[model samples]
Target chain A: MKGAARTIGRDLGRIFQALAGLLFVSILVPLIWGEYYAIPALVVAGLVPFAVGYILTSRFRDAARPGKLHGMIIAALGWFCVAIFGSLPFLLIAWTVELAPPILGEPSQTSTLAAFTNPINAVFESMSGFTGTGLTMTDNEEVLPRTLQWWRSFIEWIGGVGVIVLTTAILARPGSGSLTLYESEARSERIHPSIVSTVQTIWWIFILFTFVSILLLWVVGMPLWGAINHGMTGLATGGFSITDNSIATYDSVAIDFALLPIMLLGSIAFPVHYLILQGDLRNLYSDLQTRWVFIYMGIGTVLLTVLVYVSDTYDSLFTAFRYGSFQFVSAATCAGFQTATDATNVALGRWSAQAQLTVVFGMVVGGAAGSTVGGIKLIRALTLLKGIRFRIADVFYPETAVRRLKINGRRLNEQEIRQEFEEAAIIAALWFLFLGLGTFALLIMLPQGEYTLENVIFEVASAQGNVGLSAGITGPESLPTLGKVMFLFNMWIGRLEIIPVLVTLRAVFDRGGLYR
Target chain B: MTVSDIPIVGDLLESGAEDRVFDSLLLAGPVLILVIAFLGRSTVTVGLAAAYVLFFVAYVLYLGVRR
Candidate 1:
C-alpha cells in the first residue's frame, strides 16, 4: 500500500508537472496581450502545481513502477487535479480583473471574468474547458480579455489531445508506464509501435491539421484571431468560442459550412487520419469508423433537416437544411459548434422536441472511440448492434455449433466476443444511467418554465456526453450551485467515458490490493 | 495470379467502385440538401439530385463490369 501510494503519487506529480508546464507556456498569452495582471495569476497557478508536482515526484522517486490500475487512478484523479488547479487562472483572473481592472487598459467594465470568482463556477468553467465540453459560465465571452480567451482555447486544444498524452509524449521518460497511461486515457490505437511515438505522431498530426484548419478558416473571411481560436477549438472538437453567441455571431452559412470539414476531421480517430496521411487513402472509404462517420453524419443531417423543415422551426427548408446539416454534424461529431442559431440568433432551445431529440441521439452516439469527441462512441454502438444480431442468430444454431463473431475485419473467439459485448452493454447501460441521473438532478434543481423535459434531457446529454450544445440551462451564477457541481462531475466522467471515474470510485471503496 | 490472390492489392482496391459510390453519396448528400435549401425543394432541384444519384449508380455499374 505504501508502495502503491508512492507510485501513484509519482504519476500524479508528473501529470501536475505537465499541466504546470502548459500553464507556463500560457503565460506568453498575457504577455503578448500586455495584460500584466494576468501574468502573476498564470505564474502562481503554474508554480503552485509545479511545486506540488516536484515535491511528490522527488519524494516518491524510488516507488515501484505503476501498473494499469494506477494508470486509471492517475488519469481520473489527475484530470480532476488539473481541472481543480486549472481553475486557478479563471479565479485569479476574475479577481485581478475585478480588483486591478486590466492594467493594459483593455476592455474592463464589460468583461465577464468576474463570474469565475465563485469557486464552484470557476471549477465548472475549468472542468468544461479541460473536458473539451464547452458549456461555459460566462454569459459574454466577447468581453473576456484575449488572455482568458486564449486560455480557454489553449486548454481545450490540449484537453482534446489529452494531458496524459501530453505528459506521456513530452514529460514522462520512455518505458515509464507510458502505454498504460495512454490506454487509461481511453486511447486504444497505437499509430506507432512505441506508445511514446504514437502520442508524438498524434500530436504532429494534430499540429498539422490545426495550422491547415486555421488557414482555411482565415481564407474563408474569418479574422485571423477568431480564425486561430476557432481553428484550434474546431479541430479539437472542443467548441469553446471567443464570441458570446459562438459561431452564430457571424451568421454566415459559408463560414458555418466551412468548419464542418475540420470538425469532422476532429471527430475521426487519429489512427485513421494517420493512415490516410501516410498514403493509405483507401482507408478513408474502407475504415469502418471512418465510413460510419460519413454515413451517420449524412443520415443525421437528412433526418434533422426534415424534422426542422417540417416543424417550421426556421420558416424555410433552406434555412432548416442550413442549420440542420451543420448542427447535426456538429452535434454528431460532438464538436458542439453552433449553426443552429436561427435568425433570432438563439440556440436549439426554440427547436421542436423532435429536433432537439435528434441532436440528443447524436450527442449520445458521439464520434469514433479514439477521437476527441465524447459519448458512448461508435465502436460500442456498433458492437451492441452486432451483438443483438449475433444473439438472435444463436437461437437457431445447433448445440454443437462453432461460430466466430466478426467486426471491423477482426475475428473474435468466444471470450473475446463476450468481453466486447459485455463492455459495450455496460458502457451503454451506464451512459443511460448517468444521463438519467443528470436529467433527474436538473429537473428538481433547475427553475421551471425556462426549459422542458426535452431541453433538460438535451442539456444533460450534452454535459454527460461532453458535447457542449446547451439549451439555455447552463450559466455561471444563474444555475444553482448543486446543478453546476452536477455538470462539473458530468463533464469529468463523460470525458473519461464513465469507466475510469467508476473504477476510481470502486477502487477507493475497496481498500484491497490494486493488483489481484 | 488474379488480384484477389494477392491480398494487398485486393485490399487496396477493395471494391474501388463501391468506394466511389460511397464518395458520391457523401458528396451528393450536402449538394442535394444545399440545392434544395438554395433553389427550393422544387421539382427541378429534385431532378438534379436524382440525376446525380442515377449517374453515380450507372457509373458504379459500368466500373463494376469493366473491372
Candidate 2:
C-alpha cells in the first residue's frame, strides 16, 4: 500500500517537471504579446506544479527511473497539465484585459473576449491546435492578436514533437528501459541505438525540413511570418492555418503544389529521415508503409479526380483534378489544410459519393508509420491487407497448411500476423466507435445546427485521426460547446494513439495493471 | 546518467539563452509591422521589417549553433 502511494507521488513529480519545462517554453508567447496578465498566469501555473512536484519527490529523487507504467502516466498527466495550463493565456487575456476598442475599417474586432474566452472554448482551441487536429471552436480567428495566434499554431509545433518524447529524449538517461518506453510511445525508429543521438538526429533533420519549407513558402510568395508558421505546423502535420480559409486563402496553384511535397514529406516516418541521412535512399522504396502510402495516395487521387471530373463540377477539367488531388493528398497525409470545401464543391451537385468515400478512405489510411500525422498508420494498413490475403489463401488450401504473410521483405508467421491484425482491428473499431458516439452526442447537443451525418463523422474522424480536414463544421463561431469538447477529447486521444487513455483509465479503475 | 550526460541537453539550454528582448523583436517582426501601422509610421515599419527579417536569418543561424 505504501509502495503504491509512493510510486504515484513519484510519477506525478516527474510529470510536473516535464510540464514545467513545456509550460516554460509555451509561456514565452504571452511575454511577447505584452499582456500584463500573462505574467501572473505563468507564475501561478508554473509554481503550483513546481511546488507540488518538489514536495512529492523531495524524499527520493534518485528513484526517478521511470518504467513503461510511469511513462504512460507521465504522458497522460503531462498532456492534461499542458492543455489545462496552456489555456491560461487565453482565459487571462479574455477575462482581465481589454485592449482598446477596434477602430473603423480594421479587419475585425481585435478581441471578442466576451464571446470566445470561456474555459471550455479556450481548452478546445488549445487542444485542437496541440493535437494538430485543426477543429477550431472560434471564428474571426484573424482578430486574435498575432502572439495568441502564434501560440495556437505553436502548440501544434510542440505537440507535434510531443512533450514526453522530448523529455525522454533530452532528460531521461538513455538505457534499454528508457528506449523501450520511448518506443512504446512510438518515437523509437532508432536512427541510432544511442537514444540521445537518435533524438538529435531526428530533430536535426526535422529542423532542416522546416528550413527548406520556410524557404519554399517564401519563394512561393507567402509572407515571412506566415511561411515560418506554416512550415512548423506543416512539418508537425498540425494544420492550423493563419488565414480563416486555410490553404484556400493562398488561391495559388503554385502554393497548392508546393504543399503536396511538404505534406508528403511530413507523412513519412522520422526513421526514414534517419535512413536517408545514413545515405540509404533505397530504404524509402523498400519500406512497406512508404509503398502503401503512395499507393493509397495515388489511388485516392485518381478515383477522387475521376469522380470530380465525371460529376462535371468545374468548367475546366484542370480545376477539378487540381482541387481533387490537393484535397485527396491533404486528407491522406493527414495535413488537413483544405484548398476547397466539400459543401461548395458538393453543392454544385457534381461531387459524387465516390469522391467523398475516397476522401474518407484516405483519412482512414492516414500517413506513414511513426509520423507526426495520425490515423491507424500505413504500416497497420499494409499488415492488415496482407493478413486478409493470407486468410484467403488459407481458406483455399487445406486447413492443416501453414501460412505466413510477408510485408515488405519480412515474412510474419501466423501469430505475428494475427497479433498485428488484432491491434489494427482494435484501433479501427475504437476509432469508429468514438466517431459514432461523438457524432450522436453532437447531434443531441446541437440539434438545430446545420451539421449533417457525413460532416459530423468527417469532423470527428478528422479529430480522431489528427487529420485537420473539415467539412466546414468546425470553427470558433460555428460549433457548439459540446461539439468542441468532443473534438478536444478526440484530439487528445488521437495523438496519444488512444491506448494511453485506456491505460490511464485502467490505472484509475483496475489498479492491477499498474504493476504490469 | 552521469555528469557527462548532463550536457546533451546543453544545446536547447544554450539556444534558449539569447537576449530575450532581442529575440522577442526578431520573433515579433509581423506584430511590429501591425504596431507600426497603428502608430502611423509605415515607412519606418517597412525598414524595420526588412531589418527584422535580416536579424531573423541570423537568429536561424544561431539556432543551428552547437554551443
Model 2 alpha-carbon drift over 4 Å, by segment: A1-12, A26-60, A98-116, A341-353, A511-516, B1-67
**Tens-digit lDDT track for model 1 on B1-67?**
8744665334323322225444334334444544554665456754665465456446545644554
Which candidate gets the maximum TM-score versus the true structure?
Answer: 1
Q: Estimate each model's TM-score.
A: 0.87, 0.81
User: Can you write out model 2's per-residue Cα lDDT over A1-516, one digit (the tens) per residue?
Assistant: 345456546655655666566556656666765544545555665676667767877754545455666567656666766677667666655554443323311223344444545788878777777677776665555566665677777778767766656655555565524564565464547666576666655665565566556656655667666777887788788888887677777778887887787888889888876555444556567887776777778888888887888877666778887888888888888878777754334431124556666777787778887777888788877777777777877878987887788877878787888887898878777877887788788777765657666666677778888888877677666677677777878888887777777777787776665454
TM-score of chain A of each: 0.97, 0.88
Interface RMSD of each: 13.3, 9.9
Q: In model 1, what is the error at residue A488, expressed in angstroms? A: 0.9
lDDT of 2 by residue, B4-62 (tens): 24553334322222344332542354465455436643456445644654564465445
TM-score of 2: 0.81
lDDT of each: 0.82, 0.68
- Per-candidate clash tally: 0, 5
